[model samples]
Target: MTVDLVVRGARVLTSQFMVEGAGVAVQDGKIVALAKDPHLPEASQVVDADGKILMPGAIDAHAHIYDPDYTHREDWRSGSEAAAAGGVTLLIDMPLVLTVMPELARQKIEVGERESLVDFSLHAGMMTSEEHLRRMPELAEMGILSFKAFTTKPFLASYDYIEELLIRASELGGRIVVHSEDDQVIERGVHRVRDVEGRKDPLAHHDSRPPEAEVVAVARIIESVARVGGYYHVAHLNTARGAELVAHAKARGLRVTSETCVHYLVFTKDDVKRWGPYLKMTPPLRTKEDVRGLWEALLTGGVDMIATDHAPGTREEKEIGWDNIWEAWGGIPGVETLLPVSMSEGLRRWGIPPTVLCAALCANPAKAFGMYPRKGELAPGSDADLVVYDQNLEVEIKADRLHYKVGWTPYEGIVVRGWPVLVTVRGEVVAQDGEPVGRPGHGEFVRMGRWR
Candidate 1:
């Protein structure tokens, strides 16, 4: 039968099997059939993928678009463009340091919709006001997937407000994603570092915001969410101890889940030495033992999701000035490199399988963020979001080649073994051969719960 697009001559990774030399027929932006040797209709637009591996497009579960340093770092247009280039077809942007609260969340989402080259969602943030909580029901009804809460010092929402919102979200059946870092521990740690390191050393940053801070706050968050009977997700878990705490909670079946970023799993404190500023991020990277333990937990099914904590800051902000690590903005731009980096480091080096990659980068994240089949699956009737990858590929990452407005990646000079050669969103090729070809606004604001 004639179709809109037919991707022929590829190995399709499907739910059942990896079909060798498979051809996928697409009609109206949905996968219609997958066959060993599908007969291509005369009228259909056929694109030969040769022997590349066609897998479901990645869904980046966590990111920050429209951050404070938009022009200097990245805006929706550039970030989504980078996502396209990286084989990510769907991205959930966390509400950042934007001025407006929940009211402007929709406006910001609309702004992203106008510029996004791929499907996206906005994970809303919590503000310490009754005014914000009142909008929770409407936001959930509008299909905003989840709300983000900060429990630590720098970005704090009162425990009272957080609890109230958790209760409200429980009623709405929405998940609350928390940045779990204890306020007191972080405050004391920061102060202690200043006394010794004098705040001039960029290394003081990680020393201040230690893993113990994350563990304490994560435990509290789990307990609080359990008390409220609300589903909660721990974001950017940095240590194995933190993951163990989460595992213990899950063992009790408390509806608690957690995620760890690529940096935390691969890099550690010793690696943080020379790259001081570049190594900066909230819940900073931990020790070698921590990294090994976290990987073990991930393989053991103790971790729920993996997100690129892709926060970009300026080179000026990253430099070791008088303020240094204690005052430098904490973040690293990572959206563009998440897939290839994770695949190279996690799957290849650490023995994580393709199935785990599928779950963490595509299926599980889609389910967590309410995008599901429409965004993450390669099955019939799902959106034809796909990535054609050459596993034997090798590339040295250069900052100039990065697509984000940030124009650089913390992962510069790294050699990756696998990378995406082609990216298609809804049967339309958005990125090819390491560059984006898709136009802005081609992406739509994917309302959550629309495709369960």
Candidate 2:
């Protein structure tokens, strides 16, 4: 029987090891074979991947796409196109869901099915009320098994509520994801920065949500989840203290995992001096020392993955920060640059092997979110989601070249030494040479099981 496609002449990188000079065979949207060049099966379609490193298409664990609610900032098509261009095959969006019941989940899934160019998943959240808490099992049955909560505002769930969330979710075979920051500490710091100090500087944003706040919140969640004996993931961890806390929890077999964003790894508090409000993210950029600590944790296995947290804000929304940092939008666009930039920097600066990148950017995230075996592996029976990366291509990031509704990138002018020359999802070529070729509606909504 003729296979649908054959991809030859590249090094295959996976979580455990690299298969040098291997080829992949695909049929019916699944990987059917992986072997050396001459041993690969002849197929209906043959694609050359010479001089490239082939790996599983990245699964972005965190993204924000507010379609009908805030389409001026982003939508499914625009967001997923950016993801495809970046060699990401899946996007797990974080809507900051205040209450994710069946109707709301189905409504968003319908939107994604109609408009996306890549597979997608949703994270339900906010266990502040009995109504919200009661939906966990029902939502899990529908495949939205990961729920999110904020330790601080705009939708804060108190520590008591979060502990209850951890217990309840574990009982129902679900996961709890938290945006960690201590509310009271943030309140005091905000008063210090904006009211007492009368500072509206970009750095003031960092000071207003200090590292101590993250440590406090992370510590509370990790320990609380440990007491209940369940899975917990901390998002966008920015401080060395936070990393240390997560590392210790992991050492104790607490079943806790955490992720850090590319911004935290690349930029720092010092960058605010130049980039100003563009660097303003919640759990804002930390010191260079904190950056080093995050890198250390990542390298040592204390940190499990790296995600874009790809949120975008219009120029008008972000530009207001130059005059009043407090007023500028808190997010920046990143989905388009996540893979290319991270692969380039991770290899060039930190000696991170391609296999490690595959682990963090591909496999580990899939395992954490229960998309493994199907979406994040290159082995047979997995979806033929692949990225062909050229280690030698050098490109500078320019906003015009990126696919964000926002017309700016904080990474503009930073040259990346490598790029994804081609990308595919489920055996179909979706992007090539930095351009997205995938069509809207080609992507389907992905259902997930809770990962134990």
Candidate 3:
């Protein structure tokens, strides 16, 4: 068979290990060979990759897309465009918007198919209604990997309902992604702050939804999963204490895993004063020690992956100095900045190995989310999703330079080392330098086994 392209490189990250001074041969949309001297007998095109790292394309594993009315922050087109520029070839979108169910999930999938510039997947949510719960098997039959549930409210499912949902999902051999925050603890904290400070200080926003709440909720969620003998993943664990709880649960032989966002790894509570709304993610950023804890957890293998938690609510919804903390919407728009910022600041300055990046950012997420060898690794039979990195490249992040609809970034002034010079999705060069070249609707939905 004639290969479509060949990439000769300094280093290529493969499933088992890295290949130095090797070449990757691709045919159709799959990698055909990664050999030291294999002849490209049927090669059609070859690209010289001197002084660059060729790695598996990034899998963001978390995001929200096609949130049109709400997407002044980020949408399918802009999010995938940003993902391509960030070296992310595939991204899994979360379900929690006002429109969320199997049909709505499929509609969003259709919207993403029309707008996304890279490969994508949609996760159906576990809603509070019995009708939605009864449709679990149908969703599983549809090949959605996992069901998402939140332990807290406003729009979250209750503990009783979540437990039942987890049981049903496990019965259907599906995974569960949960946002674990003690609703009562957060509510009490909010009430206490409202009584004392009357929401005068914006910092009280962080103060009210304290880290202890996350700790309490994480432990409880782990126990609930343990009781059901189900696989449960904690999303965007923001504190050292919460991560430690997850670490403990995993050590206890429970099938528990957790993630920390780039913001938690890079920013701290002090940023709330200066960056305010930009830093206001749910389970907000903690102290410098918390940052240290998350890093140590990643290095020591406690944390499973890194995700953007890429919730892109608009600036108008995030105004600070509100008389009530509840009035200020939660979350930050950040999918576009996730990789470059992490590589430049976290990996380069902090000495995090590229293998760790591959695992947390690519491999582990793929395995956990059921994308596996297809989307996460550079090996035979894997989709030809690859990124070429110019490690020595430096760029200052400016709002105008971002591709996400949310034009601004929290790390706007941070000079960053390393840039994705080229990106490929399924053997096609979709992004070059700083621009996306792929057309809308070129991206296709990827399906996973019920729990694979």
Candidate 4:
């Protein structure tokens, strides 16, 4: 049977191994076959990959597009456009506010379907109150099995609250994803830095959120979650001790998984002086040694996945931090640069194996988020979501070149390789040569069917 398309002459990174000269054929938006070119069936359209690396599209499971209310920072269209250009074909849009009810979650999903250029999944969030915790089953039935929780300021969910949330989610066959940091530890640090030390500099942002805060909170949560048979993930884990904690828990097979953002691997608290408030982020960049530890965890089996945590803020919001870092926005744009930076730093400099990188960027996240073979593998039944990377091509990153509504990037001026020359979602070309060619409405919200 003639297929819809075929991509030939590439190193295909399937879930198992990389084939040096591989060809993948697509029919009806699903991968129909993956083999060497001569073994593939005829297709209506054929594209030569020119011996580049063909990988399953990367998935950013921790994106904050902040849509519906905070589109000035980023919207679904801009966020997914950025994802498509960065070789990311899917996003798990974690909303800034709590969306507990299924009806509200469906409305947001419909919005994403109308505006996103790449496929996405929704996260029901901010598990703050008893009433909201009661709504977990509703979201789970909608194919959303992840609930958001926080240990620190704003959502300060008590251990009792978190434990109950974990229990309920476990009962519903769901996972709890938390922003881990000890509120008391952080409060003490803030008092020490701002009140006691009287420091308002950019470094104060780093100092106010010390590694101990992360380590303490992670330890507490892991110990608590492990006892109740709760499956939870540490979002944006950035500390050396924190990585070790996850590694140890994983060794025991206690149903723990964690993700580290691309930024944590590349920068440290030291770089805070260079960029000032621009370097500011929650769970601030850790020490050089901490960055090293995170790399080891990532290359090993300790860290389950890599995420963009792709939160962006405008320049005006960041510039004010020069005077008072407390006021500057705490996030930076990352979705558009995720793959390039990852390949350049992780694969090129650190010698990370392509297979391991693929696991971190693709398979593992999909498996955790319940998207699995359809979104992660390069098998016959998988969605035709893939990227053809020009591994040798290099481009310097600039804010103007990005599609973020904020018009800025923390990675500005760094040159990166393995930029996507072609990106596809469901057998359709969505981006080519660093530009988004797909229409906004081309995307559909993928329902994650939980297998476990």
Clashes of each: 0, 0, 0, 0
Whose TM-score is higher: candidate 1's or candidate 3's? 3
lDDT at 403, model 1:
91
Predict model 1's lDDT versus the native: 0.78
Which candidate has the top score in lDDT? 4
> Candidate 1: minimum summed lDDT over ten consecutive residues — where?
35-44
Tens digits of per-residue lDDT, candidate 2, 1-452, equal 67999889988888888877897999998999988888898899998888588889998899888765678888998998888998999999887533667777888899898998888888887556778888888889889888888988888888998998888888877788899999999999999999999998888998888788998999888879777787888888888888889889988888788888889889988889998888888878888898788777777766788887877788888778998999998988888888887888888887787777778889888888888889888999999999998878889899999888777888999999877878888887878898899888888888887666
| Candidate 4 Cα errors over 4 Å, as ranges | 98-100
lDDT per residue (tens digit) for residues 395-441 in model 1: 99888887977666778898998788888888888999879998888
Clashing residue pairs in candidate 2 are none
Give the lDDT of residue 23 in candidate 2: 76
Question: Candidates' TM-scores?
Answer: 0.94, 0.98, 0.95, 0.98
Q: Across residues 1-452, which tens digit of lDDT does each residue of candidate 4 receive? A: 88899999999985579897887999999998999978988889999998999989999989998877578999889999999999999999886755546877887788898999999998787889888887877888888898888898777899889999888988888888999999999999999999999898999989888888888988988888678877888999998788889889888888788999999999988888899988888878888898788888976666888898877888999999999998998888899888789878988778888888888888998998888988987999999998999999989999888888888889999988879999999999999998999989889988766535
Q: Please, what are the lDDT tens digits per residue for candidate 3 over residues 1-452?
A: 66789888557764357667776888988998877635544578887778577888887777876454366667788889988988888888886565366777677778888988899887777466788788888787777858887777655777777778778888887778888888989889888987776765557778888888788878887888788777788888888888888888878888777878888998888987887766666777789999889988887666888888887656566664344446676777677777778777767778877778778877888888777888888888989998888778889988788786656677788888887888899999889996888888888899865552
Candidate numbers sorted by lDDT from highest down = 4, 2, 3, 1
2 or 3, greater by TM-score: 2
RMSD of each: 2.3, 1.2, 2.0, 1.1
Off by over 4 Å in 2: none
